[model samples]
Target: MVQSLARAGCEVTLVLKAPVRTGRLVDPLRGLPGVTVHSPHAAGRIPDHAVMVPRWAAGVLAELDEADPFDLVVVRGRQIAAKLAAGPLAGRLWTYLTDVPQHPAEFTGAAFGELRRIADASRMLLCQTEELRCFMESAVPATAGKSVLFPPVVALPEGLEPRAEGAPAGRALKLVYTGKFAPRWNTYEMTRLPARLTVDAEVHMIGDKVHVDPGDPGYAPRMQAALESAPGVVWHGGHPRAEAMRLTAACDVGLSWRHPSLDSSLELSTKLLECGLLNVPVVLNRTPMHERLFGADYPLFVATEDDVADALDRVAKDPELYALAAARCRAAAEDYTLDASSARLAGYLADAFPAADEKVLAAGGGRKLRVGIAGHDLKFFTRLLDYLNSRPDMEVRVDHWSALRVHDPAKGEELLDWADVILCEWCGPNALWYAERKRPGQRLLVRLHRFELYADWPRKLAIDNVDKVICVSPHYRDLTLAKTGWPSDKVVVIPNWVDDKQLDRPKLEGAEHHLGFIGLAPSRKRFDLALDVLEELRRDDPRFTLFVKSKLPWDYWWIWQKPEERAHFEEAFRRVRRSPLLSGGVVFDDYGRDVAAWLRRIGFVLSTSDDESFHLAPAEGMAAGAVPALLNWPGADTIYDTRWIHRSTTEMAQSIADTVRLGRWDADRRDGRAQVRAAYGLDEVCAQLVDALAGHAPADLGPAMMR
Candidate 1:
């Protein structure tokens, strides 16, 4: 979480317990840029309890006072949390509750009072799951609105893959149990799993005997004895977290079936997720929590020892089943990664702290660009804004002309005067408005994406005020030249930006058969062509499915406004609805945030748009190792090689089939990825924009102003 915050460009100071036993966790964080690890070293003995907590908190506060007021105080351990919550940092607190007490009903005296104080003081409570969140909220109704589901975080290990079920025939399926062996975990049941199983099994237990309390001396001994007596079990003494994960990765299933002490509905074991992170399937007791995290189809859930035996038998009988389960488990584990969970944490922190992201770094570009960007809908140009923000030399301000003042001249004039250069996205009345009020030296750059070409806005644009017209594609530039009658020299083609780094990912198995399309509903986008390609592919192989990453077509009234256009889409929709092959095979996934992960499930991405400025979705998919099957368009050749482009739907289908069968798919994927990296990288596009801006600038500003 610290690393994620630091990476997201936040200053982080990690406060740990005194006499820090620095190892794998602390050392790496200490080395990260913008990270400071502050552990208070004791001057003398200071016992941790209510007596010293106030004094200790004061000292901690004194240390924190040296810096500006902390945006958010992330209090981790339960012992020190109450003290921190009650202290000066009460309001900006986000209490992380990792280990909930098993006996919450017994909370009384100081414990109950402290718990209430912490819950009341905190801005938000972090729970591992919604189930746990509900449990905490029920226990303290004061926490109901504040708590957020903070899932278990395990960073994806590099070069780590789930154990493939390719072991030699009749090889024993290894079941590993590694975590706390306290009574609630049913450690004895886990140890007995191998003996109860009909299939050959080996249960390797690796964890420390958890000490619940100093008074309960008998608990650890009894648990350890039960583990030792169990047949077909090997008890390895506790290893460090990293080593345990490494050992667990070599096993087949992570074992965690136990007696449901307390409401099992609320319990979500982190170790099972740890196994999941390592791509090891889990043999867990079926619970509502488990079902929510892992879909109902998760085959390894066990109700009893006999059920455990049956699950083992079922997996052993078909190794492929184990492989598929492992794959699905690995897939499910992506959502719970440390980086993924930290985004949620960052959001809570942003709400609490508010100014962390806006905090400026000391060193920046010598002269800020003072770039004013005006747009009606900036949906297409968000990447451009991101690029401008990343550069220290650029300071950007945006005005939404459509949302604020649909036809107001005063607001547009104010925007034009604020900027040295004003770039209008979606060249319509917005461009015309900018062009009308531009000063002598001020530069105007208008970018025209595909949708605006058909609109009546092009002819109305004041070409004289516009110093440069940025087209997403060369074809759009030519079409705009004919429509607006702008001189050839005034227009330039800068491709749509693609962050190549995010797009590159490890492709999943059977992805080659998965066909993906980004937008499905639009008629001009030619979503039906994608279906046609999928149908053609399925004739040869049933595995083919067109995965349409889209918003619902009904949401956009523009596509249905024209009766003929609506009928065309309706016929296609009818075909998809009527045919079993088209209906089941056409997968509709709403446009998602994690495009890179979605790309991993697809082997080929289709750009079947009848008209396009630049088809970025296929390029993004290709960057993630998916082969591009592009439909021929005016500017298609300028972006991709002719080999990947097809003149017709049949040609596109044939191209996909040939690429798969003749082993050109991998090579084509590589070529498409390389093309995107070379042409549409943020740095590459930024340079082009800078150079163009420099060319249009007056001689007063030197070439240094270009970047």
Candidate 2:
């Protein structure tokens, strides 16, 4: 891992806890470019136990960091990570955990608490497998977006080719096993393979006999005895990693079969990856992770000792089968190569620590900017607020309003007096109040969404007092300019950001048959058109269903009190109850913040609203890998792809039906996900918001402002 970082042009500093007399461990890393190694003096004391070790290491790191601050501190152990997290350097820590609990039962008491601390403190949790990443995130909810895939890196011996294609005609086939002889690894059982095989074979084993079963103290000696006594078995004890790889390269197949109890492990075995890198097929237990790496029909998966023998015998008898297994192993190993791992690591690091803008950095002059956010119902701005609060260069405070047009006057005046910049989330009464009373030299920004354009607030807003008028889309930006006759340059577009990381979850089974509709109130949302589409879909396939997630119209007095709004919903509900296909097909679910979880069951998100500034439902669904079916309302083409937009309800329903029947649902889902991510990903959009708040023009604002 250190070499991979050095190769990627990173300056790495290694701090050793104790001195090393033998250069065997640190010799290879001593002379690498941009690498520094610091070891303690020979007389320095070493901590006796695991708990004390991290504490001692933390003290040493703190002193070194105080002398010359490091950009990042990478730690492997959870104990040290949690310890450092409580210190001043917490924000720069990146944790890589190897000792993760394999079962849910193990995540109780101190174990679960410790993981939560590490999750909360660390900037990144380098996971060895995707399954482990998912499991860790699920177990500790705080670790959701922090966990990243850092799979085992394959570093093969230089200039080594794969094993020869065919087995020798007259001689016995050679098989090898490398790594620990732990009880759960089933190394002892592997030695018995030669005797059980129908074809003659040689079983060679590498590494020391180390068993960790408190119940069985003599398991190690007994295993050693069996390795010596078993016929056709050769035990090569404790070789260097490079030598082990060369030895493994000489064999036709490698042994990675383990105890069935360990099948629940989410981690990938490094020994198995090494064998694959050598192009040697491995006979391993059929775990879900292994099955995903190599296909289900990989031809060498084993469940028991007999299965291992059978797999070896089958491979020895057929040359074509041996070649096929070798090719599959090699192909699967490509993703774990050093170059691939390095590229992923570099990209993740770049994202985790983006280069600060020189202008913004210089403007603050090492002092945090005092930012005051004044708004009512900050649902759309919550993510942006959290991001700004998390930054080291900004000090943020919120002035919550009692209503859209109501707030404590004295409290607003106090915030206005203290803040360097004021951001009005909505161009509502708060914006107008701030614009009318803000003092000189205080920068003010107001963001306008759809409803505000139709309201009197935008026109009554003191435009001369405002520095910038932010809109969510170009269509609205133009509308805001024409409506209020504000300067085009002052009105800039920064689309509503969807939290792609939160919403990009795996879809559930049969999700393709489920369609989702959100926010059906006020009639303009066009709940009727959604029903028509659902009816059209059910006509072709009875399995198609519509799931509605929204607050009932009666919940809002404004919509229910209006006769037209009440009648529109009453007629729609009557039709749904009367139609045979739509009776059980439409399901109404209560609206909540758990939209990310709810989206898992939806395949297609419907946006049949008469019009919108920028409908967020379809973009969010796209992030969750769902295809979107949208009506081509005015200005809809500017925000979404024309391919997803349709002229009428019939066209929308037919497009969705054709996509499902022709097996293009998954393809369309992937395309929509990619497009939405590129256009309105949270990171990119939030960065633009930050830039606007920091007194700098957004990089992408030129095109929108010109239009």
Candidate 3:
């Protein structure tokens, strides 16, 4: 169970029972990825080959002091659970009951009394069958809602045996049974089954005489005598479990029969699932449980000798019927395989430890809040995550589109269910996904920056379900409200964060006239206007030069795909190459590491974009103590102070030259850096986000937008 669960990507920690009868499996269990094996002390001081039981209470109790908390704790019975209740993790307890005696005659103080106590204390009762669960609920009414059916599961064999080159062609239909023959099972009925068959049939009984009671020593001899009298019966004594499966594979059909009077109607036969998984059909006594699992039309449901004979004869008469029955059995077995069982178990455990809905942090003690971030581009948010990481109460999880933009719906659902609060970065597909799938008690926030306003994302996204729709600036907030009809109360304006710590580095000598522009390739960024600013500044002093810090325009797919845009940049770049005033004077520094150092080389930063919600380059440059020469973009006054905003490209160029000439640039530089630090420092921005996430309104939530 642990191995299969671990293989399915779950972290499994197994607390093994004593002496670990798991001799050969112990090493294999330890080697599986994400699987941890712990051994509890045995029941005795001395080694006893017989009756090895766990004296695990001491070891388990000691482990509780140091080990990390578990989402669930599953024990076998009352005494063990009672022992574990002494620890701090008592709340995460569950119990799996095995071989429960449901009959009133077996209800001694040792059985029913102990079971009732465990049922009352446990968080849930995991049982082997629905029949067993119903009986348990009636016997202990406190366990009524807790009981769940945990059916028997079989591992599908990995390797199949290759048949001999010329194996026998027209042989009898060979039947097999690979379990002990106790008298209660009515095993003597198998001796006459061969005679009742219409087709030539043989029965192979392979097992040790394990059913012989100490009081009835003659039982083994009697069974041997009955087997010898049976026609076409091959008796193979005692084989290992794996060998028995292999032996069953080399047969035509597996057989298991019992009278329904002995509580057999309520119980399941493990052999039925085993044979079904091997693609071998079985003939079992007609019962309601089997009918529900294998379907009512399954050809092998039988009761007496005549019914058993009829089921087999029908399969033998037509090859298609036999093939169809075998296929049906394999399909039925799919739900009972180990892989299927582990997945269901994982889901149960997930529900047992659901993500907390409320995210209030109590006084004194700290908590790790599950912060989920969903987005298309993670670059902006990822840079600011370090600030949140410094806090004692936050744990961040990032979700993005998978490779090739192929979304896994199930994986997305798991992340949604696991988070206390989800922050969607853009108002695109990712935001729409959370909007549609957000659960009832979960807090969901979507961030709308500039680009999403042009795309149809804002119109398609369901903002009514969102707790908050954050905009990077007040201008975008007003624009988004005007365009999308979002509730005005939910609209918030939190500025984009800039890492102030990464700035304030040492500047290079003679860099006062080295004007810098970042991200020049985009047509909307208006590099031509910035170059015009450079053209004006260069008329006085040839020392003035333009420094561009951006990705080469040709490398960007979005820019290169449009022929007009590409030619526009190509012509601009050619002019820079042709004129001596712009030729060797203009420096094209490709995008690289050390952004802080790159910003330090330039005395002034230019923002000549046609439009922007909250331009971050100026904020980053201001933090580096550079003067920002701006050609007023639409809403530029909202992002920066009006002193920095200019009316045209000529005005921006004059401001740059006048600042350097008057030597008043130092005061402007000092104030600009302080202004940026006050408005959009990384720490304050992260706190605003976490406050909203923890279900609180930060004092700094932006100016209210009226509908």
TM-score, every prediction: 0.62, 0.80, 0.49
Model 3 / residue 408 / CA error / Å: 52
List candidate 2 segments past 4 Å from native. 41-52, 109-113, 157-170, 212-222, 356-422, 428-434, 437-442, 450-460, 475-489, 498-613, 623-625, 631-635, 646-653, 682-707
Question: lDDT by residue for model 3 over 1-707, one digit each (tens)?
Answer: 67556755577777655567656667767888898776544535324454323334535644643567665566766557655555554545677777567676667877766676666666667777655665566565556545665677886444765222221238888888878877656676776677888788888888876477577787677777767767878888788666788888788777876665753545577787888888787777666567667777888877777787888888877777777677766787787788888776776554444333334443112467777887767767864553454344667777776531456777679888888788888778888888999888777888887878989888888887788988888888889889988778888877788777547644555567888888887788888888888888888877888899889878899888999889879888888888666766788876753456577678888899988888888888888888887877777788888888899888887888888899877788888888888788765676577667776764348632111
Which of the predicted structures, 1 or 2, would earn the higher lDDT when compared with the native? 2
- The local lDDT score (0 to 100) that residue 129 gets in candidate 3 is 64
lDDT by residue for model 1 (393-420), tens? 5577887775523855666677777777
lDDT of each: 0.71, 0.83, 0.72
Please tell me which predicted candidate would have the highest TM-score against the true structure. Answer: 2
Q: In model 3, which regions exceed 4 Å deviation?
A: 18-22, 40-69, 77-89, 104-110, 161-169, 213-218, 227-229, 263-265, 355-707
- Which has the higher TM-score value, candidate number 2 or candidate number 3? 2
Q: Across residues 80-102, which tens digit of lDDT does each residue of candidate 2 receive?
A: 88789888778677788778787
Global fold similarity of model 3 (TM-score)? 0.49
